[model samples]
Target: MKKVIIAGGTGFIGTYFEKRFNDIGYDVKIISRHPHNIQWDDKKAIVEALEGSELLINLAGKSVNCRYNEKNMKEIMSSRIKTTNILGKCILDCNNPPKVWMNSSTATIYRHAEDRPMTEENGEIGTGFSVDVATNWEKEFFSFNLPKTRKLALRTAIVLGKNGGVIIPYRNLTRFGLGGIQGNGKQKFSWIHIEDLFQIVLFLNNRNDLEGVFNCSSPNPVSNAELMKLLREEMNVKIGLPAPKWMLEIGAAVIRTETELVLKSRWVLPEKLEKEGFIFTYNTLDKTLRNIL
Candidate 1:
């Protein structure tokens, strides 16, 4: 069995990665601040795990949805960068570095497109809260100078699952029949089904040569208004409530980040993943919505 080490393996994405890798005959060891079963400090634990491992995945970070002030921003940036820096040091210490080091990244790296789809080859490098956070995070990750580790930086879009990530807040509002288009409602919403995300992780692990950055999202990107329609329809709720942009700005600012995220207009497409011939089980928004519901 291939041994694998996961830092921040207890987080939102980390938990999912753990279950998938563990079920497939891989010896998985996780490093976390509060270990549920196996625990280790990132630097020391990574060196130990790298001894006979095939892969190492880093998924540590503070939530980006909270306030983006000076303090919270620092925490968000530090959490990702610091953890990876520790992992880099550990990899340096390793007698033999793992075949691959897959780290969590964000689609927020792309600059805002007016309405064009942001492919891996042509994704915009925006400079807002999302872009700033993502840029700084990636900077810290690459600061480590370990050339041997086959690095996989996954630029992930908003994940849509029945239970978590970008779904919770949207589900809450949709439950109350408040699901509607935000701002102009034309903001592009790039998303992937939870299962598709898990499958992508597995696919990346299996493919050794597939290194560098890859965008993880459905080929079909939906607009904010369209996504709202689907969510309401999926829940069998009445088509009610159009959240004005000003209301989102003033009322429930964080709660309305969904509106902002959706309204931001990111037409992101996974050109590289597609070019690499990765098939998605749930590629359509309605199909994904039905599965989750």
Candidate 2:
């Protein structure tokens, strides 16, 4: 069986990948802070895990669902950079390193643009703490010299799934009748079904010619109003209370998550994936929502 090492494999995406790979006959090994398979601090264990592995995927990072205060901001950046740096070092030292390394990156690195979609080739990187974190994370990921390894930074958008992910909160809001248009409702919400995300990974793994950054999102992005309308319809809800920017800010503070998560316009496009002829199972908003709901 092919060996696969997934760093920080305890989270939602990691767990999903673990099962998917396992189902396909890959021996999936998870490395985390806790000792599920191997602890993060165990250098010898991590090195042993990576030895002769076919793929190395690092999804290790602090959750950005909290208030971006001084301490949380520092931690968020440190967690991602530190884990990636460690993995690069290990891969370099390995006698037989993994052929492919897929690191986690966010589409939030693009500026809040309602005008155009951000693609791998011609996307404009944004400023501020979120973008800075993403920039540095990718920098560290590609900084290492691994001639044998094909590296890819997954610039992922909001991933929707039935089990656990951003979908849970959205579903909860819809059930409570608060799943309405946020702000002026013009913000673009670029997302992908969880299955499509896994497929993209598989697609890239199969195509050795593809490398570097690939935006992992649905091509058909919808505005905030349209997204909420679809969510309401999916949940069979008649009414949903709209939230102004001011109200969103207050709610974000109460929930301890950043308002930018919902307010920012993330119009990311999977140009590279599409150009390579990767077909998404749930391409449209309505179809994706129906599958998830």
Worst 10 residues of 2 by lDDT: 33-42
Q: Evaluate residue 252 in candidate 2 and report its C-alpha lDDT on the 0 to 100 scale.
A: 95
Q: Quote the positional error of residue 180 for candidate 2 in Å.
A: 1.2
The candidate scoring highest on lDDT is 2
lDDT of 1: 0.80
Q: Per-residue lDDT for 101-205 in model 2, tens only?
A: 999999999999999989988999998999999999999999998998999999999999889888999888989999888999999999999899999988998
Q: Candidate 1: lDDT of 75?
A: 88
lDDT of each: 0.80, 0.93
The sequence of per-residue lDDT tens digits that candidate 1 reaches over residues 9-83 is: 876677777787778888888888885634545456557777768888888887777656688878888888788
Model 1 steric clash pairs: 110-124, 110-126, 111-124, 111-125, 111-126, 118-267
- Candidate 1, which ten residues in sequence have the lowest lDDT sum? 251-260
Model 2 pairs in collision: none
- Provide the lDDT at 281 for model 2: 94
